[model samples]
Target: MARRPRLEPRETRAEATQAFLGRAADLAAEFAAGTPPRRIRSFSEAAPDDLRPALAILSEIPDLGLVVHGPRGCGVRAPGPAPLAVTDLDQRDTVLGSGEVLAETLRALDAACPVAAIAVLGSPVVAINSDDIRATVAALGPELGKPVVWVRTEGVRSAVPATGGDAAAEALLQLVETQNGPREPGLLNLLTSTRSPELAALAGQIEGLGWRVNILPAGARVAEIALAGRAEASLVLAPDLLGLFAEGLETRFGVTRLDVALPLGAQATVAVLRRVAALGRATGGGGPPAPPRPLSEPLAGRRLALALPTAWGLAAAELIGDLGGTVAVLSVPHLDRSHAAALGSLAERWPDLQIHVGEGQGFELAGLLRRTAPDLLLGAGDAVVVALRQGLPAAVLDPARLIGAAAPEVLTEAVDIALARWALVRGAVQNARPGYTPGWLKRSPDWHIKQEVR
Candidate 1:
């Protein structure tokens, strides 16, 4: 007898919501200060934009060359396993019209860099000077013999760090727009925030269904990225951050997007595979591999904190409670309407759950941790260090290990180890000096964050 697949609660699935950029929580307290966290989404979407840490996101596209067009001290070094070119715009260049310098930089990079394509990322200085990036790119793109695109990422564009990701996505899409190629038969673009084994495994499942999958923007081939418009459909692995790319593909190339959630846990993953198979107009492929049932309440009676992206964090928060742990503090980089359903579901279950939004503000994080005092911390990026300094047993959230069939168990193991090592983690930091002044620590976590003048 053929058995039916497991059916999780409807709330665990994707909900319809709108996405906007801005002031994603630079710190969790930004939303919680004197208002309901859910009500924070009701605010206007006209907040500032930041093209931050986007270069980091772009660099991972192994075949894409990057040129950071900015002043020398704008954190412009190549945090690379990938090659990067910096324009090295000095104070003088800022005043004297840096267009010539930019043109010269592009030509120089084209000569030396042996990558598939080059992208010029703007800095706050270049953006203010109003650099004619499009004109320059158009002029030199043919001369350079490959795609040269302008990625508008001045530091202050949007307060959302993922805006950097969006800019990079658009730049990649521009590269695809340049190609006038025939669509490849059975090709699908798997759009994901990071290239993970779990996603790779999911890609394999789609491949088994006889589709050619090109995972994009992150870990995408320069060849594949250039020809993305040729794909039949775009499957979003993390829609909260990458929905823009999917929508753009649909608009520009007429590629259909399967607006699915990041397939973490078993149910979500199974749902994704079926959707793909259905889209292909074929159902003959065997059932997708089912991940084992996760242990219930692996973290029972423990208070935990999560610092993750919006969708991933909400899913993980629910999973934590399912496995027997309580998530007291929740921190995501940004929140928009696209996340309303997931956030609403979370609110329904854990009414008192502290919702904090931020990306890498250790000062504010210190205050958040003090307020929540979670037994363990699970997160990614700069926030991990802050957790360590305060002696909390912390684990980094790896997108690679956190999705697909085994994500639930993978998270459980990580959480268990973190909780078990609390004594060791705390003991090591017992003699450490405080990273902040007493005044700052005592002040509200959102003290430094300026409120919008309405």
Candidate 2:
């Protein structure tokens, strides 16, 4: 990232599928060799596509008018701090084309609010109905005197939810299309969606180095987004929103993209800041780092299993090791080239770390949990439910908590709280309804992660 070279040009952000099953070491090796076993689950359950997250991400941008062209239940009544409208397409409208309805929604939303820019998020319903979303946006944008973009997010484009983030970033870039321009020295773009005290502090730390920091997209004005190309470098805090967005900025606007791991703990934060200083060529030294908050590693002398998203899971495992814990199994929704760097680093430290790949395939997770039987299970969303059904003590891995200065202490306290409830959970589920096949739990976790024979 410190190197001053233009990014390699890549055209499309399209993806077929993510990497298949293997050990962390093996996956890393194959990835490095450009032969990672990319496959599909033949008997996989129906999973969600990019629409949910894509709409969610776009809706986070403050004052950005958003219209999802589908039924009222398309993206649902997502409660957020952004203005969102829906086309409310009915059966007749779907058959007759909702171009008029879409234009009306856009014009109404544009007229009502002082949105910096407007985006039309296409859903599966509209894609199947073949609505002309782009033409509608193009016709209305000039009349309204504002940028209107169409973010394609059919529920079948990609299994990886982060692809939604890619679509969101592309829309953000398109909304703020700028001409080629010179960059400012020590100007860094800290890309994040949520605002937290920890991240605010981290940004302060960077600013202490006498450099300019521009927080973009989320909670940012259109002017800040326009200055994205002028930043000397870009650093993404949200892992899912990383690769495609940063790469696009570099490719289009000559910004440097720092490919660093998420700063989960104090050590990681320091390492990232140091990289930033070196890259940004800081003249005003920020001096040595301050001591982190005093707290013991709650998972010390304990072993645990991790079921999380790829980037966060891998980084959390490394941090867990630093805190004196062992990660026996690392289960993630999907793995791809974006994870190659973290995967390579993790494989070296935890060479024996068992890598479980599947997106919401709970049977495989149940089997792996039973096989390894770690003292605890750290997971997120539905994966945590799968663990608890087996009466295993588990804690939800909140991405927000696993970042910044408070992460170490926050995560430790969460583990302690979950650990205290172990006996209660174990006893309560003894008479619960059965959710898994006992025989399946005895089989290999990857039994269902079959090779793509086609």
Candidate 2 structure lDDT = 0.74
- Per-residue error (Å), model 1, residue 444: 3.0
User: What ranges in model 1 sit over 4 Å off?
Assistant: 1-49, 75-78, 283-295, 448-451
Candidate 2 per-residue lDDT over residues 246-351, each given as its tens digit: 8788898888888776888877787778777776455564665665654466678888888776778888888787778888888886776667788889899888
TM-scores of all candidate predictions against the true structure: 0.84, 0.87
Output the worst ten-in-a-row residue range by lDDT, candidate 2.
3-12
The 10-residue segment of model 1 with minimum total lDDT is: 8-17
